[model samples]
Target chain A: MTVSIIRFGGSNCDRDAERALEHLGIDAEIVWHEDGLPEETSGIVLPGGFSYGDYLRAGAMAARSPIMADVREAAAAGTPVLGVCNGAQIGCESGLTEGAFTTNESARFQCEHVYLRVERDDTPWTAAYDEGDVIEIPIAHGEGRYEIDDERLAELEDEDRVLFRYCDENGDTGPDVNPNGSKHNIAGVLGDRETVAVLMPHPERVTLPDVGPTDGQGVLRGFEAAENGA
Target chain B: MTAYTATVTVRLKHGVLDPEAETTQQALERLGFELEDLRSADRFEIDIEAESAESAHERASEMAERLLANPTIHDYDVEVDER
Candidate 1:
């Protein structure tokens, strides 16, 4: 029943994820990608980092690693998988989700706290927040812009797969509040199953109460929700 | 078996925003180069032994499809030549 946080080469957030899960009382471990996933893995976190030095595009190399096949099998079996930042890139690159996280509009790395409005509370990742509720989380990346064709974006919206969108403190979503020029201000999305999710913001970064605002604690609690079959 | 070299060129699809290319274009313009537009691409050369050039091309195309290029935002082309 432990969450396995896969740590690929250059993955700096693996330890942070481990500590955050521990702080939440969720059993977790930092599993090296070469070591493979543990048999008891009930949940997975593809922690953020510049895997493979962001070579050939962010998450491109790590997404094609042999272990990702195992992760896909587990996700298909209904195990929860959460990808953050570069992990989000891997999720999309590996087809765990749709769309692409491309270069920022400014073509530069950005590190700042941003507001995200809960688009849906029915999923485990957002069970702690109500639809339309706002949460603060930090985003740090050079290629975090969400891109998809208008037609497909509409389909994803129709399917209600969008989980979060960049917004102002008052929950108003618009281009003015978009930090990286993400299409439609999307900040997070669900995979084929809601249990499989990815987001650009670093929830684990804010999960510790000692750090600052703990608005991200709810996002990290999704692991517990999945364990309880929520 | 014949030895062939397959070249794969991967580029951003038309209409997709390419900030890196834009940045490079701006730099080039600042260097006094007149260009209506500029684009960037990644090229990979693979040498392989195959039954024919067509077979080599097929294999390299598969490589491009599987890893060398991301179809979501990239368009790729493969060319093969006997080495």
Candidate 2:
């Protein structure tokens, strides 16, 4: 069983995701969006980049691509699907997840390390971490802020769909700690099911020890847990 | 078949924060312009040949629904004119 990293046009992080999964001893492959999901696919990752040059909106064009319908089917069939950064935008746009990741509150691109407090530990994405565990991940995007209706946001919070939130080192959540003005500091969220999740941070960027902090390794380890049924 | 031009405009829903518009408003204020408020929207003009105005409106509305507007945050309107 291999994790299929779907590489849409302008997807630059497909290789990074592939290597990160390999480093964790999980077999993975990069699949072009047009070619369709392989028959052996056991998991999916929507890797990030400026798909369609961010025309109209970030991930707007890519999300409407025909392949996303299949991605949605796979996610519904209980396949673990994870989207990062621009992928997060696509996930929301394609209805694989809720809400939208729009322009940053500052209206500028931001690339920085931020702390994310795990909001739930039972999901496949956060299985390796405990609730409230703070992890560092680098987010690089101009449209990383999450926007949703107040009632919907509150419902997601009540439903345990929020996976991570921007927070201080001590896991205190507030506007001051929210780098991009996401509602309630939300940095990541699960779909209707915990197996499907999306986040603005790049777990692949921090998974390798040679690079720096491996706090994100746990996020990637989620693939391992899926394989083990954990 | 009648030739028609359909214009669709998409705007953020009420109460949704628009930072780009806010920044543009601030820039205009810095330039000494007095304005009560500022908002932004995307307009798309599509040309199509259909049997009737209603058909043209339907096609353009579908375009707006499928690609031009995101229902989660955007509300859009379509206007059609015969060419």
Candidate 3:
């Protein structure tokens, strides 16, 4: 199956994402944001980077790009879509999900290996992990905080929409453990169970064992499973 | 033809802190401004050919709500003066 990785003007993770997909033996193509997404691709990935130089808000300008319309269309058609870092910000700004705004409590950019507990394993992005399993990934962003209303947070919890939660190096969830000060320590969330996924951490950056986190293989495997209908 | 000055106070809603205003207030205090109340506001002057001041005020109010202010987090007041 083919995976479409969208590359905006400032996207730096396109090559990383492509490499990860190639390592998993999945045919991946990097589609420019100005150009439309590939029609036959089974999955779409919005890789991380400072799109539009983070002007007028982190993903505000990129969200209004030409490719996002196609991305929204594909998502509505049940095509699995994954957004990482700035991509996650764009997803929220494009109205793909609610309350994806602003910066961390510290109001500064942070980059480090963060432990994330898999809260939902049924989604296309996390199907390889067991519920509550912790994995390590790198996150780099200024506005990585997951913000939502209390009522929506409750709904997300009730629906099991939260896909990952931040934890400490020892995999313990707590106030100081969450690296970016995200609301409820949420690192990632699944839209409509599996159709769309948005995460703050860089799974692509970690997918290679030679360079990054070993646990990143599990995330790539999860997408493979979805492609293979497993 | 008549022109009126409308003062629009676009302040954050309740429970929403205005960092910009707070910073400005601190700067004012440092500048030896002993004013107890220092609230910042924006003003816009609009020129319109209207039948009455009341009608002009109504039009200005509509414009403020529709575009000048984001009602979700800000409230604006429009004042129209007869020229």
Q: DockQ rank, highest first?
A: 2, 1, 3
Give each model a TM-score: 0.98, 0.98, 0.77
RMSD over all Cα atoms, model 2: 0.9
Better of 1 and 3 by lDDT: 1
Output the number of the lDDT-best candidate. 1
lDDT digits (tens) for residues A74-149 of candidate 3: 8887777888888888887776765564567665688888899988776667777888788988888888877776
* Residues B7-39, model 3: lDDT tens digits: 455554554334446667778899988777555
Per-structure clash totals for the candidates: 0, 0, 0
Please give the fraction of native interface contacts (Cα pairs under 8 Å between A and B) kept by each candidate.
Answer: 0.61, 0.70, 0.00
> Candidate 2 lDDT (Cα, whole model)?
0.92
lDDT (Cα, tens digit) per residue for candidate 1, span A14-82: 999999999999999999999998999999999999999999989999999999999999999999999
Q: How close is candidate 2 to the true structure, as a TM-score?
A: 0.98
| Candidate 3 error regions (>4 Å) | B1-83
Q: Of models 1 and 3, which has the larger TM-score? A: 1
lDDT per residue as tens, model 2, A1-230: 89999998899999999998898888999999899989899999999899999999999999989888889999998889999998999999999999999999999999999999999888778899999999999999999989999899999989989999999999999999999999999999999877899999999999988999988888988877877787
lDDT, each prediction: 0.95, 0.92, 0.76
User: What's the ranking of the predictions by lDDT, best on top?
Assistant: 1, 2, 3
